[model samples]
Target: MPSMVLLAEYVSINGTDLSDYCRKAELTTKVEEKDVTTYGSAGWKELRGGLKSGELALEFLQDVSASALDSIMWPLLGTVVTFEVRTDQAVVGTSNPKYTGSVLINGWNPIQGSVGDEAKTSVSYPTSGAVSRATA
Candidate 1:
């Protein structure tokens, strides 16, 4: 297959376990078999939202052509563990990306007649206060 890669100006990743540990630790004090309580229920709960959101982003990427898959899934995801942003309308991007939103596929990718190196553009949006992103 040909090479496909998505680009974005920003990316973020979130993985918090402190609360989980604290809660579980507290629970253990109440139960006599506290040492036996090894299941990471709290951690699992926190991951649920992220997993669901990521699934939505992947489903959206399915609409992209095979050639665009790389730009939409590989490098951008590898580089960005949390959130992603694209200043330019390239690859997969949207005009309004929510905080920690999935990477937005280039929504306005077909623009032309610009200045500066074609490669210089990263994640960008006009002064419309819109939200552009690489996934969501």
Candidate 2:
């Protein structure tokens, strides 16, 4: 594998492509660690993988106009929406895999900034269902 600079990452939420407005994006998957150590163990602790979960976080350059970031995300609050992310805007293949999942829009910060700071909205959404990776 080679290094990635990620200049044209792709992000889509609820079927709307927000790649242009997205400043940052991340998709994370985690598995709960299950302790399997028993009294028979002398010193070593055993562990195994348990349930798996995922999350998608995004930071966007704020835009509140019609059909913009704010408009697209506001209505989806408290609901689970489909999302897809890719390393680049190109088609998904062996090199560029697409991650798709349903995320619960638990919270949103529409406006957050300081003087001279760029307007931005950052959201971290928990996956409501299984996350899938496709290279097709």
Candidate 3:
């Protein structure tokens, strides 16, 4: 049988716990493919791996608290920071797999709202280095 994980897991950014405020989290990895076709007998094109990149998108319930706002605003608008995502709720020691790496905030929308909807913010960051996965 295959195992399935819930979305209500844990995620932390620069040591601040944002799991409670986060409503959605997505991680994407992409690799560039380059054509390596040469003058060969085969007419089919060949391809080679070029580069790899990773991105993370997060949606959070807007919070006015100093910790929540400041933590996210600064990193999203200012500099690169470290982020971690876990497969479980446990923050300290756990057997769940965790992804950790540094990322530069590429885009941030402070507010997304309408008349009867919840106030939310969506932020996207581009991973700087290799995103490592390990069990803690």
Model 2 lDDT tens row, 1-136: 9587989999999999999999899999999999999988888999999999998999999999998889989999899999999999999999999999999999989889999999998889999879999999
Model 2 misplaced regions, further than 4 Å: none
Clashes within 3 Å, all models in order:
37, 0, 0
Task: Quote each prediction's TM-score.
Answer: 0.18, 0.96, 0.84
- Ten-residue segment with the worst summed lDDT in candidate 1? 20-29
Candidate 3 residues 1-136, lDDT tens each?
Answer: 9887776678787777788888888878788999989889289989988898898888888887776754566555656888998766865464677888988866667668899989888888899888988765
Evaluate model 2: give its lDDT.
Answer: 0.93
* Backbone clashes in model 2, listed as residue pairs: none
TM-score of model 3 relative to the true fold?
A: 0.84
- Tens digits of per-residue lDDT for model 1, 57-125: 211112234534323333433232333323322444355333333233233232233565231112221
Give the worst 10-residue stretch by lDDT in candidate 2.
1-10
lDDT of 3: 0.78
Listing every candidate in turn, what is its Cα RMSD in Å to the true structure after a full C-alpha superposition?
A: 19.7, 1.1, 2.5
- Give all candidates' CA lDDT scores: 0.28, 0.93, 0.78
Residue 25 accuracy (lDDT) in model 3: 84
Between candidates 1 and 3, which one is better according to TM-score? Answer: 3
